[model samples]
Target: MSVAATLSPAADVRADFPGMVTGDGAPWHYLDTAATAQKPQAVIDAMTRALGVDYATVHRGVYGRSAQMTLGYEAARRRVAEFIGAKGEDEVIFVRGATEAINLVAASWGMAQIGEGDRIVLSMLEHHSNIVPWQMVAERTGAQIDVCPLTEDGRIDLGALEAMMTPRTRLVALAHVSNVLGSVLDARAAADIAHSVGAKLLLDGCQAAPRMALDMAALGCDFYALSGHKLYGPTGIGVLWAREEILGAMPPWQGGGAMIDRVTFEKTTYAPPPQRFEAGTPIITEAIALHAAIDYVAALGPDRLLAHEAGLARQLRDELRALNSVTLFGPEESAGIVSFAIEGVHPHDLGTILDEENVAIRAGHHCAQPLMDHLGVPATARASFGLYSDENDIAALLRGIERTQRIFG
Candidate 1:
């Protein structure tokens, strides 16, 4: 079926998000969803309830509220597991965000499995979170890192990636969607390539999780990481989903409460998979809010959201490409993001001018400096979409860009 045929009309959804308006009550054009999505009222209300009337520490307390809170927290885990098509709830480990999730795997699984002369594969478009952790692990383990290049149109060159893989490759980590260019990866192909080399595959799904439906089993990836804020949930919460066997084999990366089975002075054992990784007091309220966020997106339907955002991206790219001074980046049909640069205007200046018109966008290296260097620019202005984005948002952005060009000219 054509994506457009299945899409829910974008106009009907904006009213659900309170953040879509400026303080003075103007329509706030939020084009930075790739950085972090705006929260819907449903998520806010869930969090408010979790923090206020229903507040209690999870797992430790035996009281009614505590038991209820523990149930709520664990329910959130199940929701996350189902959302990602994880094998079981036990495989879902909540961390601060995708950065910490990647670090956890690097510190625990990467440290245990990677050794001298081993190789790790990453791509030029990877977010710093995915790159730095692998680098740290490689440094400690004496493993070498191989960087996959991009295609002419900015997609991760998986053909090049397959050719680069060798028996020495221990792990292959890449982003499911490019944060800078919004180029989508063929994750299943990447997985097959990694497996062909007898290497594990890890996908940073921070961008993809919000806009597309994910199935970890179908993708055949060993690990998938996602951030809550990017998924329209609260900050300080994220998920790391791995196969149960892989989680069982990896040692604990951190030492703290809740993650332990029993604490003793001499030697300490740990709890089972997910809890062992959790370590400290969990993000209880955030987890509940994440559940709500998942429900919100699910009800709206991910396929519909994908189509809506893709349509907006196509329109924005087309309009921006027609401008004489604007140079665009990424694919013709990006997941939901468009990055571009004006000939004489720095992205920061463009961002500032756009803000003056109340059209917000992201402008900078976007934490992918390697990609910036590859594109031969310091930074680009990025306009990303969400369920709330529509034709009006794109119109405002174009108007702002026209103003920017006039100011520069």
Candidate 2:
């Protein structure tokens, strides 16, 4: 779909987010959700309870409270797996964030499967998290990397990606949505293209999981990654969902106390699948908070959130386009973000002025320096929306832009 065609009308849920208010009690127009979403009270309460009354290490605990905590932890894993439509909970591995999840795959699966002269296809709009890991793996594996171009509308050029795939292609990795451009990918089609060339596909769903409905089976991708913080949960927790067979086949990325079956001087046998990948002390409270975050979004409905944010993004783009000096990037119907630059003012200057007006936005390269270079600008000012955002926030942003222009003039 060109836009969020199935999105319903925006819901008024700002009160659910405690961070939506400024320190002085004014309504804080937070427009930088693409970096990290503000936590809901449900998530906060869940984490508080987990850390205070229910604290316990998982898996090895035998006491009643320990057992309860272990159950909660494992239940959280199941919830995460179900949320993303994983084949089973065993396929879900907890990592720090999507960045770590990508690295895990790169180090474990890529190192095991990718070899000399093997090709890996990547898009131009990939986040540094997605790009750097693959680059490191390719350097080690002696695999060659091919860069796919983007459409003029800022979407990844899948046609070019299909053309780029060859018999030697080992993997294809891309974002489910561009963090900077907010362009959504046709993940199912991308999966098909990769499979046609006997390659596995991995999607970074940091941006997509917040807005779209995800089904690992329907998407047909071998791997999917998401960050809890981006989904209105706590940081230090994210998920890597891979095919069960793939996880079983891949070697452990890290070694530590919990991820081992037996340890000895001669050898150590690793635990199965998910446990094998999660080494050392896991993020206990963060997982509980992530469960609450999933529940919060589920109650509101992902489809509704997608529509609501898309509406805000479309409106922002139209209004910004009306300004003669404003140059917009991304497709006409972005998921929940709008990136643009003023003709004369730098993005940092615009960001500063916007903050003075209580409208927070993201400025600079946004961790995608290659994309910035591709766009032929040092940086762009970005206003991203969340479930708490409303038309009032958009109006505040426009007013701030006008103020910035006057100040520059």
Candidate 3:
């Protein structure tokens, strides 16, 4: 049962995204989607409208436009709630990005819950965002950090994770999908393992949320984080979703304007839950654009996006494997990300060559230097697919790789 045989492509979607073309209207073969996604015209239009005609600060002014902007901003939160299957908008706290989201959880929740001798578990495949925040928190709180090993095939080893869990384990933070390898985590299993020892699970959903249909309850994770840019929306807005009670209990990480119930020189009272965490001026235009992006993705079908990209991943892997000069990474069945190293070519060299062919690929450690070390490679050339990626992009990549191989020889 091959992934390609079982899955279909998110067909004919490239046209909706304006960035798919170059200055001369030639196709731009974008394969760096795991880093960030290209925005659809719908999202751009929504953002343009929001920043122009509907521009107003939220939750402050008694003016009519301010009230409407506030309504639109809150509506965006509800839309994310609907998209991710959170209990309500109260569970979603918008931040700068997934980086900030994780840092907030680490500072607010980790500071309070984790203490001396408490263990915080993370995996080898974590993005620096996930790894660094926990490290900062652990250092401050005197918490011990435990690194969970990955399976031979690159997936997070849940069996090993379960065995590692102890009563002292206060938190287990892992990626829902590997940003480098495209290895999808069995989040429910991880969540169960974390909870078995009375620890909370935080899933970095930056890679998963765009492709997979997310349900906070179904996943059983205590917290989930995702970025708007990766979800085909604007930057400067991301989400941190926690169980309603957990978010309510977690103290505000930052303090300022809108988050306060009332502020006095003598004493300051804070707002509740999401509002308390949001602090000052929120991501107004970005949130509204995110709402539009969610609508665009929903219209395409979230579950189907995974299937489509997985098929492409299988297709690319098969083609790259045939080259024999290419050393592929990750499992055979992965989401729409393929990483490999050429026998004699540096990833950066290959990337530059591909650029001349009007093809774009990510060539670096991808901010996962630990995973790069584990894989015994300095870095890899990664081709990550989005809803707009298609066979044409793959063909262009293969052509560029062949040219690189010839030049290297």
Clashes of each: 0, 0, 0
Model 3, position 209: C-alpha lDDT score: 91
Q: What would the per-residue lDDT of candidate 2 be over residues 174-284, giving only the tens digit for each residue?
A: 999999999999999999999998999999999999998889999999999999999999999999999999999999889898899999999999999889998998778
Q: How close is each model in CA RMSD to the real structure? A: 1.7, 2.2, 1.6
lDDT of 3 by residue, 191-293 (tens): 9999999999999999999999998899999999999999999999999999999988988889888888988899999999889998888899999999999
User: What lDDT score is found at residue 396 in candidate 3?
Assistant: 100
lDDT of 1 by residue, 1-409 (tens): 4343346455677888999999999999999999999999999999999999999999989899999999999999999999999878999999999999999999999999999999999999999999999999989989999999999999999899999999999999999999989899999999999999899999999999999998998999999999999999999999999999999999999899999998889989999998999888999999999999999999888888888888888888888888988899888979999999999999999999999999999999999999999999999999999888877788899999999888889
Q: Which is superior by lDDT, 2 or 3? A: 3
| Model 3 segments more than 4 A misplaced | 1-11
lDDT of 3: 0.93
How much lDDT does each candidate structure score? 0.93, 0.92, 0.93
Error of 2 at 185 (Å): 0.3
Off-target runs (Cα >4 Å) in candidate 2 are 1-11
